[model samples]
Target: MSHAFLKIYNNKRNKNFFYKKQIIYIKNIIQLLIIICIMHNFWMEWNNFKKNKNISISHIIINGKKHYSNDEYIKKTISKILTTNNFFKLNLTIIKQHIKLIPWIQKIKIHKYWPNILKIYLTEYEPYAKWNENSFINKNGDIFILPKIYLEKTVNLTFFGPLNSQLKILTMYHTMQNELKKYNFFIYSIRMSRRESWQLILTNTIELKIGTKDIKKRLNRFIKIYPILKKKNKKHIKYIDLRYTNGVAVG
Candidate 1:
């Protein structure tokens, strides 16, 4: 081969080798960066796992302890169905449902304090009056099963109505009760009939048949003339029928 041609060939071969080395170096650098990125992500995940591993339910506090519910029972129930034994991993929705099943529990709020504590705030139903033998009406007019211990005690303003009629009956009872209290008249049992008529019996066993129509008006009329009627014939009347428009029919 000629020296000039050989020299040119050698130079081209060296150039090709240099270009190959540069490509390999760049590939190695890219692989190292990828490895570093992978290691960084793995380390972050490992650190998170280590932190979560130590999280657990260390403390539980329940507020509003009265009447039917207490802390131990609530904690016991929450422990049973809690998705994770760890307080940090507990599902609030599931715990809320379990807690709300406690009788008379009206409203509840749950909060998770980080690192191992949980707080439960509970609000129970407010009992307005007694319904039937073993149930009570809340101030919101919702009926709840009364604890048996309360059934024996005399409940003020005894009420009876269709299950759906609780709100209506309760409202009517309150209105009449306040008005009647002025005349020293007290209701023994107020019942709403199937026909939607209302009749209330007094503590003295005298029934006031204030039918469906003009019920409030009839009650007011009875209250207005109660003193005169009681004086004239306290024991003479069997039942006072306020269904009459012109005058109260005495039965």
Candidate 2:
């Protein structure tokens, strides 16, 4: 009788343990379901907020303008549609793309001030170097092909290179400027070679051949020798080869 009673007691304990486990598992499942429902509700609310286009763009903000006349037309166009409400849809990539049509704008940030206002911030591109055949390049390497009228109004450095040659050309131009500061010689234009070497043309039409490596020492050598050579040679030399480890060879 004692052994049979003990067996029954052990079975009850085992069943209670399983019951407790099941209760805990159900509680966890309920918590997960509640969290999922809350997330779904939040997503739905966000969708409604995007669809609420009743509030139109009350104002347009512009920053970093070099010349006002060139960008006035762009601002006028934006102002026309600026009053239209409900443009910010859930997948409204079309409206976002239309903002880039502004000629002088380099980048834009779109946001909502809420209740009754929309805000747009635009950053205008400044010319870093002159592109080939009448264009301009920004500091970020973006090329802007505008009318010749814009070019005539401003002076920028001429930079020329093939598709893969931009990095090398930009580096060489900067290096030349740094070394030639003592001689007051700044590079007017940079032309790249097929072999990846750089040919720098200075203000006085002085041509310099800078190889792919050892730029500083080569330029320093030229700076030391250029004044002395210029005084001796009354005739304008064609080119100066600074690639040599010894003294520069002038022709």
Q: Clash number for every model?
A: 0, 1
Q: On residues 1-251, what C-alpha lDDT tens digit does candidate 2 reach at each position? A: 99999999999999999999999999999999999999999999888777764656554444444452344565565554555544443222433466677565667666656544555556767777886647777766777655567786665578887775655666767777887876798887888767767777788788888786787788887888888998999999778998887978788
Q: Would you list the clashing residue pairs of candidate 2?
A: 53-86
Q: Report lDDT per candidate.
A: 0.81, 0.71
Task: Write the residue-wise lDDT of candidate 1 on 1-251 in tens digits.
Answer: 69999999999999999999999999999999999999999999889877886577668888875666767888888886554667555788888998888777888899888767788888887777788767888878887775677666736667888768888887888888888888788888899987999899988778999998987789888878767887888566678899888679776
lDDT of 1: 0.81
Query: All candidates' TM-scores?
Result: 0.68, 0.60
Q: How far is candidate 2 from the true structure (C-alpha RMSD, Å)?
A: 11.2
Q: Which stretches of candidate 2 lie over 4 Å from their true place?
A: 1-72, 75-93, 111-119, 243-251
